[model samples]
Target: MAKKQKEKNNEVILALKAIVEEKGISEELLFDTLEDALVAAYRKNYASSGTENVRVDMNKETGEIKVFSLRQVVSEVNDKDQEISLEEAKAIDEKYELLDMVQKEVTPENFARVAAQSAKQIVTQRIREAERNIVYDEFHEKEFDIVIGHMQRKDKGNLYIDLGKTETILPPSEQIMGEEYEFNEKIVLYVVEVKQNPKGPMILVSRTHPGLVKRLFEKEVPEIYDGIVEINAISREAGSRTKIAVSSNDPEVEPMGACVGPRGIRVQNIVNELGNEKIDIIKWSEDPAELIENALSPAKVINVIIDEDTKSSKVIVDDNQLSLAIGKEGQNVRLAAKLTGWKIDIKNEEQYEKELQDALEKEAKEDPNVEKAIDSDLENLEKLEDEADIEGVIEDVDALKDAKLEEETLKEEEVLESQNIERDIELVPKDDDEYKFKETDETETEIVADEDYEYKVPEEEKED
Candidate 1:
């Protein structure tokens, strides 16, 4: 009988060890849990003689268990919520107060069997809950990154996704539009966010986000994942059209062709996975004009004018190309505008030309050229006054300048004649046919005026 009891004790130790191993919970943690449970149960009426003070401990090597119940000396027989009177509280610990809960240890041999079982159950529940949280925390670490899961079942119109042992919920709103999920369907999802609630940890998955598209591209295009190429931007209206801009580090490999594959096999596979949603693969450019042109594809663009401050642009197309450039109800340009974050206005070449001509006419109407020309003609009258100040027949600047030249020549001739005999200087008198000198004295005063340049001076017909 002595050996049999020892064998039974060995069995208990082995059992505890197996639980810790299988559950991945440590033996030390199990002891702490047992101690806490015993304390709680003893306080809630688990001890003999109505005193439930307990001390619980586990042997590290043998896994031996012991329990103690605790209570405080009380003077009153009222509600159990009050542990003791002020006098009794002082006996256990001097700092104890009246109506204060105090502790006095009583071994489990001092408690009933039913009370011990209740404490054991409580401890077991707590251990299981801790294990569950450990699992939740492990999976939460993988959130917001790409993940693959099997479709378990739909609950309340939401997908119960199974990531191995744990189940994640894919809410109805997050499911891809028009994409069907069969039972146990293998699928990929991008984790949008993780939220904790009273029920459990909620892993939010997405299939419609632009990030989803980018991630899908990365998965199918191995070059993207390995960092040889990168996706620059994505603009998508899921289940309809998606535009992705891709660039590459390698100069020889065309990023677009690599994505599209030979004979369009690569992109075709991606499109098939997405339920045939059309994709427009475009090369990204730093120039806004080039990007905008690429965004509105399948349509020839005449010109693109941008207002960078507001991030807006005006696209001009040929008259026959307008409808094609804008699509139905401006859908083409609208998609382009969203893709580029620019407001786009599409106009035909004729419309643009008309607008340009109208602007030019309006500018000419307000110009000061015509008014200045009229003022210049009237101002010539005052110029004649300034010229008439000199005692001369020449009132016009050009004519006065010519007269000055002639006078200078004659002065030179008279000086030369004076150096010689005065008889060489002839003062020719007018014989009706002989000319009299009527030289203009507007010589130096005309210096301030702009020189007049005209072919033949027929005053009435000349334009100055």
Candidate 2:
């Protein structure tokens, strides 16, 4: 019987070691849980006789179990289990005095099966609690970061993704619009939050988070990963479009080009990962005007007028480029506004001019120097008009000067011709004697008698 009892103690020690190794639970904690459970079981089965001072102690190294009953030393003992006479207590300890509590060993006949089962339940409960704490600590550090997981299941509109040791929730609100999630499909998600609950760690992840796009770029673009290119800002409309601003520390590196990669493979990969979401990689600039220009991309911008105090900007584009700048239902400009943190008012060149004209007129009306303001505005408008038509005006002036010179030259030539005719008449001999006449065949010729002159007469005249 002694040998059999020794073997049983060894088995208990081996079982504890196995539990510690298997569950990753500390032996000390297991022992404490087991002790508490054994005490409860002992009281339930044997302490029904009002023995309320029972305690159980276990030796961690040797796996020894002992039960003790504590009794207070009293002048007179009323309940034998709860109190002892001073004489009886002193017999056990010479220093015993009245009102002193003393312990007496009360080992049961055997460690009952019911008590062992209760201890098992306690150890199991403790293991589960320990596992929960471990999972919570593990995921708590991962909050606000990207994680890779496989789709585990879906209920209603919520998805459960298996993230190795635990599962996370991707609710409908956090899912990418128009994106389909398939079973066992590997996907990347941004860990939005981590919470502890009665069931386990509740990890909330998202596919539509702007950080998701940021992290995806960081992963795909080597420049971003190596810190050569920094992502300055990101604004995403989920499945529709996203705009990101990036800058490079190295002047030689082009931020937008680097993110775009060769033939746009780098950003294209990210776009594919995000369910074909359109991405615009813009070069960041410190100048608000330049930055706003970059933020509203794929559409040519004519100018950006900024109000530093209001942190707002007016963007001007060509009339034909208006629809592109504003995007479908104003999504482009909206995202650009978000990316730059500036209230943007986008207008075509025509609209801007009209607004500017109206504003100037309104200002002119409000000012005390209304005439002066209106005059200044008119001067500005004229200057602008002149500047626009300078080439045409210069050409017209040159053409008019040429025409006037030609008209004067024609008039002078006519005057000279008339004077020469008068001079010829005057020189044409006041006397006919200065003339010479000749006849040939049936025609008569008269000459002015000058070497430069040849004259012929008509047939009718020749008859005469």
Candidate 3:
């Protein structure tokens, strides 16, 4: 019997070792839980009032369990389960006093089925609780970070991402709109929160978080990871677009270009991960006006008028660029406001001019002197215009005089050419055979030369 009992203890020790190894639970914790379960089992099976003081001891080395019932020695026992007579207690120990408590071994022949079931339940509950604590500690350290997980399932529009050791919940508010989740699909998520619960660690993750973009950039862009570039701000409309502001601490580095990478390879990888969502990488500036200008990108801005007191800005764009600045449903301006922490009112050049004119007109009506001031300003402007007109007329007259001199010089040269041609004709020999002549009695050469001279002078005068 002794050998068999030893073998049973050895088997129990081996089983405990297996459980500790498989469950990743501390051996000491398991032992304490087992001792408590045994105590409860003993009270339920053996104690009459179910309130008897029972103690359970387990050997950590051997996994051997012992149960003891504690009873007080009295002159006369009133409760048989709780007290022992002095005479009876003296049989076990001679030094027993009237109020001395004695302990008796009460290992049962067999544990009742109900007690066994209760013990199993207690053990299982304790194990589950230990597991929950372990999981909570593991995930609590990972809060506000990025995690990779696989899509496990969806329930009531909430997605469960299986993150290796535990699962994380993606709430509807954190999920990208119109995004389809597939089973077993690998996805990246940003851990927003971690909570400890009875079941396990409750990890709240997000797909639409701004941190997700920052983390993705850090992962894709080496400059961000190395701290050469820092993300200053981010504004996102999930599944549509995201704007990120980054600045470089190193003077030699261009923050926007670093985030964009060579030929946009860095940002493109992040875009693909986000289901082709558009990303705008803007250079961060310390000046609010320059920051707002960069925040509302892909739209050319004419100027930015900032109100320092109100922390607001009026952005002016060309009339045709208004829609681009405002974006579809005002997404561009909305994101710029978020990124810059300023109230941005976007207006076209025409609208701004009209608004300015209206404000001036209203101001003029409010003050009687404003009208007189405006009249004086108009008079000064007209005088300046008149002076400009006189200057322009003087310049035009000088230009015309220069042109007339050039024309006179051209006419004198033409007259000299005509005289030369007449001399050449006179130099031609009359006897030359090239000049065919009929012998007329009247002197026709002088008449012909004189008629030519008269015809040329009238034609030149007509041209002049």
Estimated TM-score for each candidate: 0.60, 0.69, 0.68
How do the residues 230-249 of candidate 3 rate in per-residue lDDT, one tens digit apiece?
Answer: 99999999889999999999
| Model 2 per-residue lDDT at 430 | 39
Candidate 1 worst ten-residue window by lDDT: 443-452
Estimate, for each residue in 245-364, the C-alpha lDDT of model 2 and write its tens digit: 999999999998999999999988998998899999898999999999999999988767788999998887767889999999999999999999999998875675678789777887
* 131 Cα displacement, candidate 3 (Å): 1.6
- TM for candidate 3 is 0.68
Error of 2 at 93 (Å): 7.6
- Give the alpha-carbon lDDT of every model: 0.67, 0.80, 0.79
**Candidate 1 per-residue C-alpha lDDT over 194-266 given as tens digits, one digit per residue, 9 for 90 to 100:** 6665555667887777887887788778788888787988887777778888888888868888888879988
What RMSD value applies to candidate 2? 14.7
Candidate with more favorable, higher lDDT: 1 or 3: 3
lDDT of 1: 0.67
